[model samples]
Each structure stands twice: as C-alpha cells, then as structure tokens.
Target: MTIEQEKFSGGVAVITGAGAGIGSGIARRAGEVGMTVVVTDISAERAEQVAEEIRGAGGKADAMTVDVSKPAELDRLANEVFEKYGSVRLLVNNAGIETIGYAWEIPVERWEATLNINIHGVIHGVRAFVPHMIKAGQEAWVANLASIGSFGIMPVQTAYMVTKHAVQSFSECLYLEMELAKLPIHVSSIIPGQVKTSIFDADAGKDEPTSTARHRQIMHDIMKAGGMDLAAASQVILEQVAQNKFWVSTQPEMTEALIEGRIAFLRDQAPPSLHESARQLLEA
Candidate 1:
C-alpha cells in the first residue's frame, strides 16, 4: 500500500538533524498528523527547542541529542524513544555535511569528516536503529537525504557528491532487501536540488566560512534562484512517505536533466548535458 494509504496512526518517528532545515520541517509535518516525534540533533539545545515547539503546538514529541556519526549516541537515542514511545516506525537519516573544494585542495581530514557524517552517519543510523526496528516487527520507514548533486557531474563537490550518490544507491538497495526479506519496512532517498536551508555553513567556523562570511548570503541567493523552500519540499516528503516512494524528488523543471544524466551514465557516454547555468555553478 502507499504510505498515505497505510496511514501513520500510532507510529513513531525519530529524525536526525532536526535542529533546523529539512529535518525540522519533516518533524513538524509528521507532528501535524499527531505522530510521536523524537527530534534529534548534535545540538542538544536546538533539538530540545524544536521538540518544545511541537509540544507547544499540541504534538507529542521528545528531544534527544544524537550525533549520527556516533553509534552509542544513536543507540541511546533509539533506546530512549522506544522506552518512552514503545516503538519506532520511522528513521530519518538527515544528518549530513558537505566538504567542497577542488579535488586537489580538499583536505583528507575534512573529506573524512564529511563521510563520517554524511555516509557513515547514515550507516550508523541504520545499523543502530533498523535492527531494533525490525526486531520489533513493526511497519517502518527510512528516509535518507541525498541530493541532486548525485546526478550532476558538478565540480568541486568531490567527496560530498560521492557520498550522496552512495546514499542514493544504498537506500535503493535497502529498499529491495526489505522487500526480499518480506519485512514491513520502507526505504526512500530524497534528491533535492537546493532547499532553503543553512547548509552553506558547512564549514561555519572561526575560519572557513568564518560564520560572518557571505555563506548565508550565497545560500540565500542559491535557494532563491536555484532552490525551493523547506516547507514546499517537506510537503512532497510527507506525501512520499505516505506513498513509500523510493525516490522523492522536486523541481519538475530539472526532471529532464536528471533523466538525461542517468541515461548518459548507463550508455557510458558523456555526462548529461549541463544546465544552462552549469558554467556559473561549476565556477562557484
């Protein structure tokens, strides 16, 4: 059955990276339907703040500090959720980081950190949560955040792009595995182009973007020109979850680009034709 047709009554969801951005939006949407939400993030206070907002709005929610890269943290978060909510039917692996640099300029440390959070974060989240979720034998769902970067041969994203592509393929494989196991679990990957979020602050620091740099300004412009808002994307995600769609995508305008990109990869031809703004984006 479709995610919506299956209904979310009595289900529980635990979302990582819920302090803000797409993760928070997803939590809010799930709460709107009266589901129990465990809002988790590396930032403990922010996660709690979001949880408080949910409760203030008459939704059941709990906040926990969870670093997706840490298995112990994820395990503790899941334990707390099950202890309180009794069951968990959803895991949103949304904690991610992007380390962008020219292939030569990229630091191994930074690249690994990105993978620790982006790829391994998803890995740890699933490893720590899914076994328990399955052992509980409940109908559940897993949503891993990928990106359109997975499709683009866009330059400079390097490790970030590689990790996202891995996420996309990993999610698909998990979905099929669940089906083969005859388990009542659903898996999906989201490949959004650029949602209105604070992701540009990836290196938000005393140095990198320096916190006061033009990071936000650039991200804002990107979202305005090349991205969609979080709310709009969240609606599609909820709809997708309800439908158990394997791929949740947006910006119909980019549909053709993604299609052609995939076709090129399969035929061992050139990467898909670039978007009109590809040059400008690549230079960015």
Candidate 2:
C-alpha cells in the first residue's frame, strides 16, 4: 500500500470549499484512499453533489453547508465533526475567493470578504479544531491553501495577493507552533502555482470592478490553457501531506522562481514593477 493509504486510510477528513475546484479534487482523493470525507461549501447543492459522487463510487462521504467566512460557523463545524467522527485525521482550509482590481477600486464588502475568507478562515479553522486535535492526541494533518501569489507583489491583484501572503506566514508559524508543542499534528502550506479552476470566471468576479472583465477573461484563458490537471495536482498534494512535509507545492519550480524573485526584490529594495504579461493583460 502507498504511504497515503497507510497514514490516512479509515480516517476522517474535513475539507472546506469541497464543492468545486481543488477542494473537490482533494475530497474525492481522500475518499478514494478509504477515508470518510466531509465535503463542505457555502452552497449546499454543490457540496451534496460532490459528496454523492464519492458515495456513488463506493467511498464514504457526507456533505455540509459551511461558510468559512464566519468564525462561528467554523466553530460549530469543528464541534459537530468531532462529536460525530470521534476524531479528525485531516483538515484542509481551502475556501477562498479571488478578487481582481485595483486595491482602492474594490468595494469595502469585497475587500472584507476576501480577507475574512482567505485569511481569517484559515486562522479560525485552526483555532476551532486544534484543541480537539490536541485532546484527541492523534496524528492529524492540517493543510492551508497558499498560492504563488504569496511570494510576489501584484498591482491589480493586491487584495488577493495580500491574503495569500498572510496565509503563507500563518502556515509557517503554525508549523513552528506544532513543533514547539511537540504535538502529533502536521501542518502543510499547499502552494499551488496554477491548477485548472473557475476562480477567474465572469460570475466569480461579479464583485470586482466592471472594467476588470478583460483581465479576468485573460486569466481564465491562461488557466484553461496552461494550468495543471486538478486530479493530478490533488494526488501530488496528498502524497506530500502523508509524508508530513511542511511545504507542499504542486509546482516546485514555479514556487522556487517566485521565492527567488521575492528574495531579490527584498535584497535590492526594488520598487514593484509589473511583468510585461501583466501589463499587456491589464492594458487589454
């Protein structure tokens, strides 16, 4: 048997934003590996659909509606999961929205949503669940979704970039905390370079500035053309998580390049400059 099966089989996995995209892929993979999967999303219908797919495949799964933007909801979710499952083997804080536009141009509500969902969501997920994990005294895994945007600066994508940076830092500190406490929990920062998803779809960007339609379309096309396969990326991520690695990246080369650029920018104290492709996309 594979390492993932050895570590995770017959355990319970709670994943946020499992209705679609990478979250859905990971939930499916968890089920495939013989875990009982709890698939959660803001949309009840979508969450149930994904859970049903897993059940149909002869895997165990359940669906729940969870809005990660609300800390209370996360608390309730943790309470319920622990009460029902006895213990959680894995928890993935993966619900996030992409906001595209100039920082000043984005609406207050959208900015709050982005920050609350992307940053606070991950924070509260840990806050609500770690105590249970500690009390259970079982080896558990927590994976927070970071991105390539975590390392670099972006003009129009400032809101999204800010949250990613925060998440990366949070994950780093969380890993250290686990080590300091000598807990049986493993923390992983999942840095995905580009995997196929609907983050930039027109409907997903309805809260952004109307003028950003072109930029959103451009990014959507780019993802469609060059993004990694969702299932393949999920498999890589889980394999690394089972190994208890802190840095779980879908594309290590891209992560390395971004980190290098970030280092140079910091070392030289360079002003932020837009890449030519970003310039073209914004100008188009």
Candidate 3:
C-alpha cells in the first residue's frame, strides 16, 4: 500500500541468490507487483525453480546461474537478463557466506572464501551490471546485502564482520556517488539482524546447505539457536525499500552499538592489544 509498493509494478528485477531465503522472498515479492524477474543463484536448478515459481504465479520470470565472485559469470548473467527483458531496473545483491572461529583459530582459507563470496561477489555484480543501469536512464534500484556484524565484531565471526564492513562501505559510496551523478537509480543496503535463513549455515562444510551449515561448532550452535522467519524479515525489508530507506534493517537493537563504536573509534588512540590480535592471526 506504500508508494514504493505502488511504484514497483511492471519493473524488471535481477536478484542474486534467488533460489531461496531472502533472495527468493524478494523475488517472489517483486513478482506480486508484476515485475519481470531474473532469478540467479550458484545452483542452476534452484534458480530455475524460483523463476518457475514466479512464472507459475502469473508473473514474468527467468532464471540463470552465476558465481557472483566471478566477473565473467556476472557479466553473462546481466547480458542474458537484459537481452530478454530490455532492462534490469532492480538489482538485489544478496549472496553471502560466513565462517566462525576464534580469531587465532580461524583458517585462512575459510577467511578468504568468505571474502570471495560475501564481498567480492557484490563487487563483481556492481562492476558487470550497474554501469548499464546508469545508462538505462530509468529509476533503478541497487540493493546490497550487509549485516549488523558490520557495526561491531561478533566474537567468533571476524571475517564475516570484515566482509560486511566492506560491503557497507561500498554500498554507501555507491549511493552517494550515484546521487552526485544525478541518477534516478536508487541504492539501498540491507543489514539484517538474525533472519531465519540458511545464511547462518554459510560455512557449513560441503552440504547442499538449504540453511544447515556452520563452520564452528559453537557458532553453529549459536546460529541454530534461531532467529526471525525469513519471510517476515523480507517483508519488513521490502516495506523499508518502498520508502527509499537506504539502511533496510530488521534489528533496532544494534543502533546503539553502531553509534558507540564510531564514537569510540573517533575518540580513541590505537590500542596495542588490537595489533597483537591482528599479528597473531596473520603470522600464523
């Protein structure tokens, strides 16, 4: 019933990680408004399933597989969507991963893998697609997935926080830069608190992971403890989007943490303990 809800009708959207969870939820919601959707995921079958679901619901839909960290794959996916629909007015970069461990105990591969998928994936999508959106000369949207972790470090999930910080910074810069260029394309970033999605299983080793994986036993336990329904969270997010809200967030709890952390960072001197932790992790 919001203005944004009224406005999204008849648009064509490209959503990453659209096979399930938040991505599927966004794609389906986009469908409800009669938008042509291109569902993309690393799993081709799952992506196709999401697209088919939209089609089944009497909406325009298509599907593709993309490893978002790879520029070539992202470029191809963009071209395919544009070739069929003429424009990709909305882009949701929602693919990500997380691994949990004590800073010193974390595996370098796990850290790198998290960055590759969680951070660079968004980079690749932006690089391969956003310029074309700028040239399209329409009121477009770019939504990047971030997390509350970017506000402060979660004890065992250092890499996830780091990557989210990168994503948050990138999305913010993009939003400001686009505005400076007088573009109508809107930019938003979602920093979900604890949506009930398989995102918690991001580092679950080697399983198909329809939401059931965690790198660390304790972290997995913490995640398995549970959160809000993915559908419900997605709905909240969409409502925010309809308002041109850039920080589409579900958790009101972390606001203070965000405020305090920045204030402390601004007022404090570098602590030696911080360097020790970094050195221990890097020199291992």
lDDT, candidates in the order shown? 0.77, 0.94, 0.77
Name the regions of candidate 3 deviating beyond 4 angstroms.
102-109, 206-218, 221-226, 261-284
State the lDDT of candidate 3 residue by residue for 1-284, as single tens digits.
65545767778888898898889988988887777888899999989998998899998888888888677998898887767777777899998876665656556776667888899889888888887786777788889999877766554566678899899999999999988988887888898877766755544544222222233444445555766677777777777776788988877576456647656766785441333553464344
TM-score of 3: 0.84
- lDDT of model 3 at residue 69? 69
Model 2, C-alpha of 113: deviation from truth (Å): 0.6
Candidate 2 — number of clashing residue pairs? 0
47 Cα displacement, candidate 3 (Å): 1.1
TM-score of each: 0.88, 0.98, 0.84
Best by lDDT: 2
For each candidate, C-alpha RMSD in Å? Answer: 3.2, 0.9, 5.2
By TM-score, the best candidate is 2
lDDT against true structure, model 2? 0.94
Q: Which ten residues in a row have the lowest lDDT in candidate 2?
A: 210-219
**Lowest summed lDDT over 10 consecutive residues: which window, candidate 3?**
207-216
